[model samples]
Target: MLHIFCPHCGELRSEEEFHASGQAHIARPLDPAACSDEEWGTYMFYRDNPRGIHHELWDHVAGCRQYFNVTRNTVTYEILETYKIGEKPQVTADGKQTNAPSTVKGQGEKV
Candidate 1:
């Protein structure tokens, strides 16, 4: 079983204590009531299922009962990092720290 570190609880807990909610970073529509059925449906149901690094929202149901973000590998099922809702991940999809200098020159913007 994969041991997941809960950012809120500050302890490593078993995976059974949590539940994978879905794809993270889903932005709610600016005006939900103004959306058409098709638009609303797409916003509510559409999610990306990538083969590589995937960011997910998880709920610590059996622990602190708080929700957090998890960056994990889809194929290897490796939990890269867990963080609070408002915090940016230290690592990126290419397995590099966000603050690290890039190889390409003049492209130092956050992706």
Candidate 2:
């Protein structure tokens, strides 16, 4: 079992004490009523399922009962860092910021 360090509790605890929530830092729509059906649907259902580095939200369920962010490697299952919700992650894939969209090489032919 993996031992996770709780930011709030300031102690390392077992995995059973924490609940792995979905992707962290998801921004909720400011005006939900104004959002289109597609936008709202994407907000509710869409999440990043990348292969390498992943940032996740974890709740200290059995300990402090507070939520925090964990930067972990998906392939090796290694926990890189555990931080508070508002804090930015230090480790990133390829040392590049992943917020921007990657460029596609080919263009579609006109029909």
Please, what is the TM-score per model?
A: 0.84, 0.83
Regions of model 1 farther than 4 Å from truth = 100-111
Candidate 1 per-residue lDDT over residues 1-111, each given as its tens digit:
788888888888888889999998899999999999999999999999989788889999998999988888888888878888877776677776688432211111111
Q: Each model's C-alpha lDDT?
A: 0.79, 0.76
Clashing pairs in 1: none
After TM-score superposition, what is the CA distance of residue 17 in candidate 2 from its true location, in Å? 0.4
User: Which ranges in model 2 have alpha carbons more than 4 Å from their true place?
Assistant: 95-111
| Model 2 RMSD in angstroms | 12.4
Alpha-carbon RMSD of each model = 8.0, 12.4
Model 2 lDDT, full chain set: 0.76
Candidate 2 lDDT over 42-97, as tens digits, reads: 99999999887888999999988999888777777777777787777666754344
